[model samples]
Target: MPANESTNSPLDTLWRVHAILWMVVAGEGLAVVLALATETSSDRLTYFGRLSVAIQWVMLLTLVAIYALRKPLSRIRPQGVAYVALCLLLINTWVTAGIAWLLMRDVGPMPAGGWQALVLRLTGIVLAVGLLGLAAFQNHWRARQAAVQAKQAQLESLHSRIRPHFLFNTLNTGVALVRRRPEEVERLLLDLADLFRAALAGPRQISLEDELALARRYLEIEALRFGDRLSVRWELPGVMPAVTVPALSIQPLVENAIRHGVEQLPAGGEVEIAVSTTPGTVVVRITNPLPHPGSHSHPGHRVGLNASQVRIEALTDGRGSVQTQVAGGRYIATVRLPVGT
Candidate 1:
């Protein structure tokens, strides 16, 4: 990985704030213990307590500045989260120490003036904050490294699941149809090939034009197998090229409509496919006629429904969801995904 990638994630900034606070607290505790052991002066406890609180206030003020700005830097470098933290460290440490020294102006190395005391205070602040930044950046790098590793594992899992489960069943259906009525088999097989190509392709997103083409092919194959038993309708856009969607997202729902919806109802039913978009999201709804609970046939049990849910969830980074319910004797599964990642 490039060094700059490590310079970007926010998790490191979180840890740096936390670690600095803990070290300052621990250092105060150690100073108190030493004073007691060495018989340095009971009055010194007051100085340690005041310095610790002042340093902590500086850290807290820096955090408040971070939250208030919220844009990483006020302007110029929007991506400079690390640089902001470093600036906060230097300023907070220097300012907090300067204030603490003012309160105890008569004590320590600089008995001359407040400005002289301010310089001495900066020394500890600089050392402590500098060291803390180093530790935090290491953690940021490791966490991102781990994220890359986990993503590889997930892609491999998707690779295994990518084999078309429905294809085996689909081809079998085509073979049976060919044995009984061979004329439509060639047309059906071509459609099947196109559908498989869509599944195997690796683009993260696809144009709706391609999705409609693929969905149409899959629908044609079902139409061949089911004959007059399947009724399909599309509420697609007039300008098809204006739309795009996550690859294969629409078809699996369509497959589920066939497996659990159309194929389940022997007397036949209507399957409706539609897509629309809102300000920051895309909506796809698949609705099909419902059968009496026990009277319905499940295509390969409930595997299709279960698998589609898992696959969509994985692809969306948890921003998308699928919900299934029966309303007015119609089974509806609507999927919602954020418009852009």
Candidate 2:
């Protein structure tokens, strides 16, 4: 998904160039027999062979160009890629075979039923295979690159939604303490800083223990503002998976619960977060009261929570997911993470 990756890797391109053009040379040798069999003028057939040899070089340049033009190549449709590959295959074979026959003229006729004729036959076959292989693989790699790019784009869009959602909720909470006691501003500022730090950490991968520590830090900050109104129930047991997950994965769910589910209610409510490993999977669940009967939401009430869920699925390639349900005036969100990931 990175810019440099999409573009041709210079090292790889160099290797392919060195490696693949030999297929053309090998194909040209096969053209020798075709040249001997054809009735066309020797000069004309030789010219055609030379042209085919020239075309192989053009193909090498084209492949290099394809690598250099990384973005557009991935955007190419599957069928279009197939068409291109087929065209290249045919063209290289036609051109190289003709050139081989022409070049072989000076070398003398193939000895009938002898080792010389056998060598020419084998060389032709090898060239055909090599050219076909290159075309097939080129299309496959392009398709793979396109898929990866699309997935990365989806992940970025999901992560982009997080900053605004968290900021809105945190600032709203800060405004409450401001009216009653402005002196709490400094302490609140520190909490806000910690919250943002957890939010903006690098990379989508981190250890599970680190994610939990971050979630706890975030909850501690929120607890200062909410006082006893917000309570935490951590149900993590012995031996947690050390696998990586999106950074600060659990905090947003708890934060969302505190902001929209519990903070609005007069009695407040408890936020229960539990994590445990089962076989090859690790599960984390957070539960909070609905604040009132018949509680429901659309988007804005839980954007931060949704962002985290989207990110987890993206990072895990659907190996992880979040399940949510409202039961008995309580909203519950469960996250399933693959331990093997």
Candidate 3:
């Protein structure tokens, strides 16, 4: 299996939870909506109440079934999803059948096998409709997964493109300072090593502290090149919260500030990086002097920014975002990540 797919495999989610409970809750909500739409006013409450009970029973039995068969299910392959769906179907069928039996047991003068026959018919209809819905859900989820994988691949490609150009520039800067400032060259190489390590760490997330450190290293290397012209100011909290961010997410933004903003001016400029949090969101703002008009094309400018935005959205499941603009002679980039506990 491909590494990304392996890392994100659905099979690994078999015995794990959270996503399944969310699915159950969503299914119950849809059932409530359907009942409200189709059932009459007087019967709506009773139907809704019965459905509520049925959902509870179904969820309870589903959990039991998962507990009993978790070991075997874990070994089930890519077919794990189908097997899980089948398990839920059977559990729902039996639960519905039991409820139906209890309701009809005291009915007047029914034939000996009437309840069984009714249950068979009801179960057949329920299974038919339920399986169709499950199949639709599976298809939709697969399509979404495919799209996420494609986006991740694109972001990785963007990351790979960034490293080469950045390394080349930093190396040239190192060569320039090699004879004049040999000791600084050692620090420069160490910073470069740290920057590339985070870059090639794949598409996983790292802590905010670590990401900030990576960005600091990148700025440090640029500082070596620009010396006093490339100053940086950091506005960080005294107590850094244990939040996570996409690897290399902040560094690329800092690199953009250095390459396009400060480097364009003869006197150069200072870059400001501020980290703050509000309620459940972690906000990072990087500000640098805007480049002169028509000076040069910033290669990979949009590419890197878009990739970083996509990665943030993907990492936070759309709870994070990026915004950039040139305002008041400063190019400002802001990233907001949902704080994770």
Candidate 4:
């Protein structure tokens, strides 16, 4: 299975070294108490050692088998995960009992009835451990899924608000210039169509190239609206990193720059968009001339900025962030994203 597809189940989450170690330790501790109570042997250390070694071997072997089967297991549906887990537990118990039986027989004469009883008890104990572990894991998985669903819903809500606001603004721009620049209207409409098409795309994420194209279209409309007042300066790297970003993320920051900074200035100003990469992160910076004092400002821009910031943070699970500030006569919005995002 693909690495990305492996994270879909709770079973996969439980198959870690630390978790396996915990299970082995807990199971062995319980087994020691049971063995000491049931056996008449005066040498408690020998009895404890036997159970410890058996439990350790069984757990280690089972862990290895689980690791080998993880790819196939991860593809199983949520409902089937428990059944598969129980089946694995049964197999692990039988293998462990066989090994323990062999070692016990070599050590000394072992009664057949005693061995049979020991195997049954071991199977029951291991099955109980498996069931408890599965329950805990399933609960954790449900909670995680709930959180993701909530975040997704919030993002979609915020995204919906942004889409209509942008559409109307673009439509109004087109309407305003329809008669004066009849020829430009065709190109304007095409850009508008492309923007909406991208907005309505299947996934909530899009490649950096697609995102940049969408932002450029928005800027194109703003350029038409502001005429010579809006200038764009791009400092893109030689090659754009193949990274995915939350859709509609960059364009909103660009819109904020045009709305609050460039248009507010008397002679207009430049919106500089720069993209660069570090070892594991991709950074996007948008800077525009700071708004002059007493300049008209829309309060909605602040709300929109906050919303976009929240959406990006949610999509990247807080690995990505947005920061904005006015310093050195520039209103700067910077986004830091992990390359894997």
Candidate 5:
């Protein structure tokens, strides 16, 4: 199975805002618990305030160290990353505890025990907390890996569904042309072969220009079948953006326009494809005239549109979308992709 292109490691969570906030809360909770256990009722409040300062300092410093080395940590296995994080926490805790002892040894009421005993207790607490954090990290990593695997499996299934449907439809079109225009059958087969090559390439990204070229080839094959009945209008930008889209993303929408829109009309209608770009996104729209309500409508499972939508969303981490709506008596299928994807 191919790995996700944009998946982040579990260790990466350390730098997230919410995760950091949670860690701070956990540290404060630990300080409160320790204070209640080791201090008298009258002094527990002061002990908690002091312990929170030391604990929070240790946690924040360890987090900083981990973030600074995040690139190297990412290169290591998850187990190794967890071990390193635990080690950092322990080291920070010991160092912070030592500093607190040196600074405040004579300032206030000690926790029944002397500085050495306090150091021992702090080390024990840190080791226990570190182990618990390690376990949590392992669980999170396993869960994330499982989710990625499930998503990849779904993408593969969608791809499988799309390939057979595309192949059958193209083959039927070839069959229709084979009996009438034998010479054109060769060109149609060539195009079909190219499309199949892309469809079978598995989950991957292709340049926007390459995707458009593939869509154009598919349209060419359909043109041979529709002849004068099928007319296409293309509106494209002068300079295409440097971006990648999932394979076969655009072609399926074109196929839907022809099958559901143009093919239903007696005097086949025009299919308009327009591509435009903004500062951060690229949009493609396919429009075809709808047949009258009483006229014969093509019966379709809408597999292509649904598959395209799913594939785009999966590949783009939900940043891209496929949408369809009816306006001005025309059915439009729109695809939006984020730039720098």
Candidate 6:
């Protein structure tokens, strides 16, 4: 599975703003229901005020406990996590109800069944709500997991299609070199083997530095075919941050630069690869000159660029992007990845 496919526990979901809002709404609804069920017309307002405090206290304390233990709970099975959350809810309900009972005893007379009965009634309500919430969370989680799996399967399929195209391109480079540059053919084949190995390794992430190295090897092989017509300018940061990107992500874009851009121009052009970083993002840009109008440039299908875009977006959980544009007679492809992902 891709690293980004890992699902968060239900406890994590509870910490989200929308989830918290829903909890507050549900708690208010429960308070209203309890007020109507147990209190007389005259005492309903007073009973609601006290019940609201108790319910909110129970909900808040239970949420806090879950938040504090979220990391540990994430390691356990989903069913076990649900069970633990319900246990915490029950415990908090009893503790909050006991405190409310003692504090309100001197304030007024007890209801028909007294504090003990109130506690029991509160426990039943807590259990029912807790079970219902858990069931809803489990269903939501399963749906999310299924969607992630489907996206991953689609990403893997795209990756598999990309590999053959890369392999065939590199082999063609090697075949060209074998006729006139027999000595260089051995080195070309070795580089081709390394590049293919990485491509064939299946869906996984590679360090930014490692991915750049692979792109360099690919360019080296292409250089053997294009000769002096192909020149590369690399602008790298002084220190490369520790970042991981989908494997083969950068290489394909570089290949596109050579095939569709430099290879079409008569006096070939420079391929500029620039890597820069912001506080929370790493950006890579590849720029190559566009062929002149009426030049023998074949229409590009953009298969590699599209595949790279999908893989990057999927791997980064939509936090990263691959974009391309044409400006100043140059075809520019840019990739942005979120830092510390």
Candidate number of the best TM-score: 6
Question: Can you tell me which runs of candidate 4 are displaced by over 4 Å?
Answer: 1-7, 11-63, 93-119, 301-303, 310-314, 325-327
Model 1: worst 10 consecutive residues (lDDT sum): 1-10
Model 1 error, position 177 (Å): 3.7
Q: Which stretches of candidate 3 lie over 4 Å from their true place?
A: 1-78, 100-113, 141-145, 200-204, 292-300
Q: Quote the positional error of residue 44 for candidate 3 in Å.
A: 9.3
Better of 3 and 6 by lDDT: 6
Error of 4 at 236 (Å): 2.2
Please give the lDDT score for candidate 4: 0.77
For candidate 3, lDDT tens digit of each residue in 1-341? 01233335454454446767775776588568756765344467776775667656765676667667656765665446565756686767677768756785685345335767755754665577667767776786688678867876777787677667566776777787786688887798899889767666667777899989988887887787788999999999998878777787788788888888898888899999999999999899999998777778464556567767877777776678899987899999999987772
TM-score ranking from best candidate downward? 6, 5, 4, 3, 1, 2
Better of 3 and 4 by lDDT: 4
* Stretch of 10 with least lDDT, candidate 5: 1-10
| Cα-based TM-score, every candidate | 0.62, 0.57, 0.75, 0.76, 0.81, 0.85
| Residue 162 in candidate 3, Cα distance off native in Å | 1.3
**Candidate 4 TM-score versus the reference:** 0.76
lDDT at residue 37 of model 5 (Cα atoms): 79
Give the range of the ten consecutive residues with the poorest summed lDDT in model 4.
1-10
User: What clash count goes with each model?
Assistant: 0, 3, 0, 0, 0, 0
For model 6, name the residue pairs that clash. Answer: none
**lDDT at position 162, candidate 5:** 86
> Cα lDDT for residue 21, model 5?
92
Best candidate, lDDT: 6
For model 2, how does the per-residue alpha-carbon lDDT over 208-291 read when each residue is reduced to its tens digit? 787777677667657767787888888987877777777655777877777777777777779888887788888888888875
- How would you encode candidate 6's per-residue C-alpha lDDT over 272-301 as one tens digit per residue? 999999989999999999989998888677
